[model samples]
Target: MADRNTPNRPRQRIIERGIELLLALCGSISLLTTLGILGVLVWDSVAFFQDVSILDFLTDTQWTPLFADKHFGILPLLSGTFLTTLIALLVALPLGLLIACYLSEYVRPAVRNVLKPLLELLAAIPTIVYGYFALTFVTPLLQHLIPGLAGFNALSPGLVMGFMLLPLVSSLSEDAMQAVPSGLREGAAALGATRMQTAWRVIIPAAFSGVMVSVILAISRAIGETMIVAVAAGQQPRLTLNPLVPVETITTYIVQVSQGDVAQGSLEYNTIFAVGLSLFLLAFGLNTVGYFLNRRYREHYD
Candidate 1:
């Protein structure tokens, strides 16, 4: 017995050490990937700024870098990006919260088990498929109701992008609501509050930080979305608040320029990195806000 136990202890220790090393390696890979992306964006953007001033890039309204007369204004793209993101959030936020509240606070365990996967299936579809569906089906449907709608515009793609991110928001928010203590619900019930009342007053308030995180993540995803905007929305960047007209987002512009015929090291090529840097910064700022919000408002369960 002593010989057998001694041998097994050494083998188990070796296996545990190997598992720890594998986990550490996986963690380091993510950190290294993030660092690599930041390094490339900053390096290329620095080179771009040597020729085109940062002020013009931020202030200029035009984005035609490939034409004989190059205009490197980035505001048009930013405007389109904001317009579409705002449109998407308007469609998503209410729907996502409603779905989350229902799933977390109302549904029976068996029913929830059956329904959650079906709802999440929306996320499994390829994004390019959503782009085509918006372009072919949704846009045509919208045009029928509003005859002035353009063939390529912000509305259809924004709507599709909103639905695409719905599952993510719902799932995260549901988890947060469900994490709230059952004791809170019981106390609300003792005060004669109904389930609906308890959910809105106690559960949602307790989970507000988590709900905000889900919303911020959804916003970031909408801003960075490429294919849906590229295929459905036109490549023309216009600084307009109207969603019916053709517009281009930063992600779409990046895709467009990447596919175009342009020489390497030219201003046209350099603009890609500059736009990428701006996009990175935008997403970073949003996520940073989310982090602080979560930290500031998070409730301790114990």
Candidate 2:
């Protein structure tokens, strides 16, 4: 209460205010950036919809915007996006859950420290490198087994994207499992539950909310991935579920149109923004689901 008598008290208050202002600005940056992106997408999408009806955009089966006979139906792109994401989930989920269980329950702390980082390094590899690896290596390996697999198909990229997302799922799930109280484990042991049974029945159910959130976020990430799909998943936008055939996703379409060949103000140019908005909405929905799941079912322990 007598700090006003201190010579440096006023200076300390000013410094504290300055630090608070700086931290607020840093936190606001993400919010501002997200608003900026949404604004741009809505602005450009308005123009695109002026020329192309919303009904056609939703109902059109083909997406041949660059061709002489132009079409803007987004179904093909959506199908392709769905197919690749499905493949990636199928590949990542079980393997990631197994890896998480092993790391959280079985591995020694020292070994987990070493192994987790090594596993996470897969995520650090540039996505373009994964793209090229899928195109050059995985595709070739698959061709030897599948009789009529296209040179550029969804399977290879989907598989590579799965590997890339493995670390994210496993890491998040392992952290959630680790957060469960040690007393739970001890109680299970006292009840004569085997280690495997305890981990499966007790720990997993307790951490289910976190694990579910991680899976949702991973699905969003797989949907939004770009380069690997761009390189290995072909540019042909076809409404097909055959992973052996070439197809293009919403993200692949955005990359294709953003390559500077399309004029900046043309309908083709505006299509990118429209599709960008769709992708944004998809991701936002997935994130919303994850957030709600985290909030609603999250366990509280003192």
Candidate 3:
């Protein structure tokens, strides 16, 4: 009996070791894939800069890669991207914060359970559908109301993008607000504070850092979004601040160039990488600021 048990124990140990090794290998492969993508992007962007001077790429405002006067000023694209993102944030931030506040403090539990999932469903909807809606429904509505709006202006697309980002901001901000200790609310109430007063003065201030992180995350998502902008926003890359006119964004440019007959190894191909690098840097910087804000400003009530 002892001999049989000893052999079985050894086999069991071997099986456990094999499972552990498999999981470790899988994790390593995932890490390698992420690192590989980053490596390729960096390498391609560096190669692009080698052919085109960094100064020209950064400072030139016109983005005519196919014409005889091929200039690659990335600023117009950057400005368009920023402008749209700013508009989206302006529309999303207040609505998202109010939703977060409602869910965290004001709503009944039954209502919250029903509504939260429905709101999150908005996030799960495919961006292509949003793009189509923007093109068909939103643009016409804007044109009817504003009279001077184009068939494809920045306002409709930006507003739709804001709607898309609202769930993310609200869900994250709600979680942060909910994480505030109940004792704080109780203390405020004990001190004769109303529910709204406690929420606005104590809860929101305590959760400000996390709320800011959510807002930044929404902005990042707005910046990286491609499909809605590609389908709804026009392909004209201008440096104007007029939101009513047609404008091209960085992501839209990438989609336009990738879909068209732009030859590989040409200046146009390199311009894609240059624009992509700028986007990557912008996202990286926003994420870095979010990290610092989370670290430095979060008020721990424990």
Candidate 4:
């Protein structure tokens, strides 16, 4: 018995060590990948900044770096990105919250189990399909109602992107609401609060941090979205707030420059890296803010 147990212990220890090493490698892969991306962005962006001043890049309103007459102002792309993100959030937040409240507070477990998966299936649809759907279906339909809306405009794509992001917001929000203790609901009922009142006043507030984290994540997703904006929203980089007109986003510009026409190692080619770096910064900022907010407001239940 002693000989058998001693041999098994060494074999088990070897297997455990192998598993530990594999897990450590898996964890480091993501961090290493992130560092690699940051290094590339910084390296290329340095070359791009040599010819184009950072001041001009920030202050200039034009973005025609592809043309013979060059401009590198990022405001147009920034505006378009923010515009679409705002429109998407407007469409997603209210509807998502309503759906979440319904799922979390009103529905039975059986109904919620069935409905949540159906709702989340929307996220599985390819983004390219959504882009084409916006162009072929939603844009023409909107043109009939909105007299002057362009064929390739921000409104159509923004709306489609909003719907694309709906599942994310609703699913995360529902999870947050579900995390609230059942005792809270019972107490609210005891105090004569109706379902709507309890959800609006208690559950939502309790889950605010989680909901906000979901929203921030959705915003980052909206900003980083490429296909729908590229296919539906035209490539015209104009710094305007009107949703009826065509505009270009940072991701679209990266896609445009990456299409093989632009020479590698050239200023135009390097612009993508610079734009990508800016996008990285923006996303990082939002995620950092979300992290702090979550830490600040997160509730710990016994």
Instruction: Judge candidate 3 against the unseen true structure and give its global Cα lDDT, from 0 to 1.
Output: 0.87
Q: Give lDDT tens digits, candidate 1, residues 135-196.
A: 99999999999989999999999999999998989999999999988999999999999989
Residues 1-302, candidate 4: write the lDDT tens digits. Answer: 89869879988999999999999999999999999999999999999999999999999999999999999999999999999888888898898899999999999999999999999999999999999999999999999999999999999999999999999999999999999999999999999999999999999999998899889999999999999999999999999999999999999999999999999999999999999999999999999999988887874422
Clashing pairs in 1: none
TM-score rank, highest first? 4, 2, 1, 3
- After superposing candidate 3 on the true structure, give the runs of residues whose Cα lies further than 4 Å from its correct spot: 1-30, 299-302
Where is model 1 more than 4 Å wrong at Cα? 1-21, 299-302
lDDT of candidate 3 over 158-224, digit per residue (tens): 9999999989999999999999999999999999999889988999989988898998899899999
**Residue-wise C-alpha lDDT for candidate 2, range 1-302, written one tens digit per residue:** 57656978888999999999999999999999999999999999999999999999999998999999999999999999999999999989999989999999999999999999999999899999999999999999999999999999999999999999999999999999999999999999999999999999999888988899889989999999999999999999999989999999999999998889999999999999999999999999999988887777774422
Provide the lowest-lDDT 10-residue window in model 4.
293-302
For each candidate in the order shown, give its overall lDDT on alpha carbons: 0.92, 0.94, 0.87, 0.94
Cα deviation at 63, candidate 3, in Å, is 1.3
Error at 105, model 4, angstroms: 0.8
lDDT, candidate 4, equals: 0.94
- Candidate 4 Cα outliers beyond 4 Å, as residue runs: 299-302
